[model samples]
Target: MTSCEVGNDPFLITADQVGKLSKETRVSQLGEIYKQDSIVNRRFDSTYIFGGNEIEIYETSGNQLLRLDPKTPGDTASRIGDIRILDPAFKTEKGLSTRSTYKEILENYTIKKIENTITDAVIFLEEIPAYITIDKKHLPTIFQLSTTHKIESSLIPDNAPIDQFWIGWE
Candidate 1:
């Protein structure tokens, strides 16, 4: 594995890695990987609902950082299927974070596609295995409500801020 740091920081995100967690990091290794941070396992409830194997990582200061979902629920050996970045401190090497805007994203990476959902426009990046969402409120009226309508990247305002950012291992 390459050195975890990007510059002087270890929290930098890349296409194949997120800080100390790489594509090969497994569910069983979370505790060891985040030993300095707080780890919370959100297991399924008694109602028999299939709540996913979501593992939350928090700073010692009580700030949430990331939510990790394993590829196979209840399987300790499963690799991370998704990583939801919750803190703004976790930024891509290109400086894209949860706080980044569409313009920043466009300037830093190539857009693969734009998917229109009822409440948001999901922007997929070509250079990175990640996607960012812009809330419907930031979109033009025509593209806000209809899921059937395909949203082009050009339609989204450049200043629209990303509502959520997620990295997919799959």
Candidate 2:
């Protein structure tokens, strides 16, 4: 009878090889921005998502939300060009205006004017202003573009860096 068994090889998988394999692969996703009711009872919420290298910003107040999408979907290629938010006071060190709501922001803003125009049967934002207004309150309040909440970036991935055990295999 012929023996068809092969001996185990420990040299093929060494300690260094195992260490190299343990290195994790990671992808970044944006974070959520929100204001809790516990503090001042202000109604503000925002969720940011980054995937395939693109950034998305979703802002919510009351029952309204606005979404901003990036040009690039690849994480390494995407960058934040310009971001504007309306808040409580129209004062900042950066010299940006701040109104309480979207209506106030648009009214106080000096750069862009809100006018009606018709050309190709489509209504669009013609002149991109320095700030975009998100008016949540409409009534006795003086409508102003004010930024009360701060925007930030966060990382999101299915598995943490320490969890990705297998990747880039031939």
Candidate 3:
């Protein structure tokens, strides 16, 4: 087995590391890195599509753990562009996970920005270089109706739960 396949905790997440995977880990190494887990690759039929290949990691018990997008689709050597943490078991050193609330995030990390999308509010964190998204339904009616409006931290309720958590290598 290679170095990538051994001695790395699978549940720990950091700014430059997630379990056995790191910023330098390539697409080809995923199989080895996740040898104990199940990997499902969903590639687009067309080669023209960018960021179309999504790789899912699942536990033996059939619980989805993560969704990874490669920097370049179909390129075995490509590093991970981004990773979406699907399981609440996977957490950062500070104990932030999918189940963490907006208030917990505020207490733990520095907020870089809050981006308003059609259905979600994506909050960027400076320390981990990660983003946590909250569904717009959790927001106030006025904030949910406008996608162009700048979403400030104070505008979000402390009890709002995170809908998605993503770590970007870039």
Candidate 4:
């Protein structure tokens, strides 16, 4: 990832810069790489119209990395007005990606488990507006890194992977 577009160090990609990334991926000659996708760049738009271009998709994960518009999630997006990252290749300073298990998150950040019955659960952080949603094992599924006070309850696609959901500024 050091030779990648974002930069040489994954730690430089802080929680604040999460949305700027292209949530989609592809298996390049070098390996799996995640670059900026136009649809993801246009996700902040309130309009639900994306003209005629086919939404860019990540090859390996098969997740729609971008959307025509978030307001109308009939296509790829689950909701509008928020950053959603489903790519496991994206990592944190400690190399904790969406693919990391719940137990791994505990090692990086000291957090108590939240009693959740649903498949999608959240780990609310006291310091940052971010809340980490994880599976039963405590692995991070999605990160609600919202500083703008967006509603937590948003639409999630039926068939989309439950591993990565980013809820923050679009």
Model 1 lowest lDDT segment of ten? 1-10
Selected candidate, larger TM-score, 2 vs 3? 3
How do the residues 51-119 of candidate 2 rate in per-residue lDDT, one tens digit apiece?
Answer: 422222233443222122233333433432222222222232222232232333224333223211121
Higher TM-score: candidate 2 or 4?
4
For model 1, which pairs clash?
none
Reference-based TM-score of each model: 0.91, 0.24, 0.92, 0.42
Query: Is candidate 1 or 4 superior in lDDT?
Result: 1
Q: Mark the regions of model 2 whose C-alpha exceeds 4 Å error after superposition.
A: 1-69, 82-91, 94-109, 115-129, 134-170
**2-51: candidate 1 lDDT, tens digit per residue:** 33432346578888788778888888887877788899999875667766
Please, what are the lDDT tens digits per residue for candidate 4 over residues 111-160? 43343435545555432223556543332244333223322322222222
Q: Write the per-residue lDDT of candidate 3 for residues 118-151, one digit (tens) a residue.
A: 9999999999979999998999887789898889
| Model 3 clashes, total count | 0
Which candidate order results from sorting by TM-score in descending order? 3, 1, 4, 2
- Model 3 — TM-score against the truth? 0.92
Sorted by lDDT (best first), the order is 3, 1, 4, 2
Task: Give RMSD to native, each candidate.
Answer: 2.3, 22.7, 2.2, 11.2
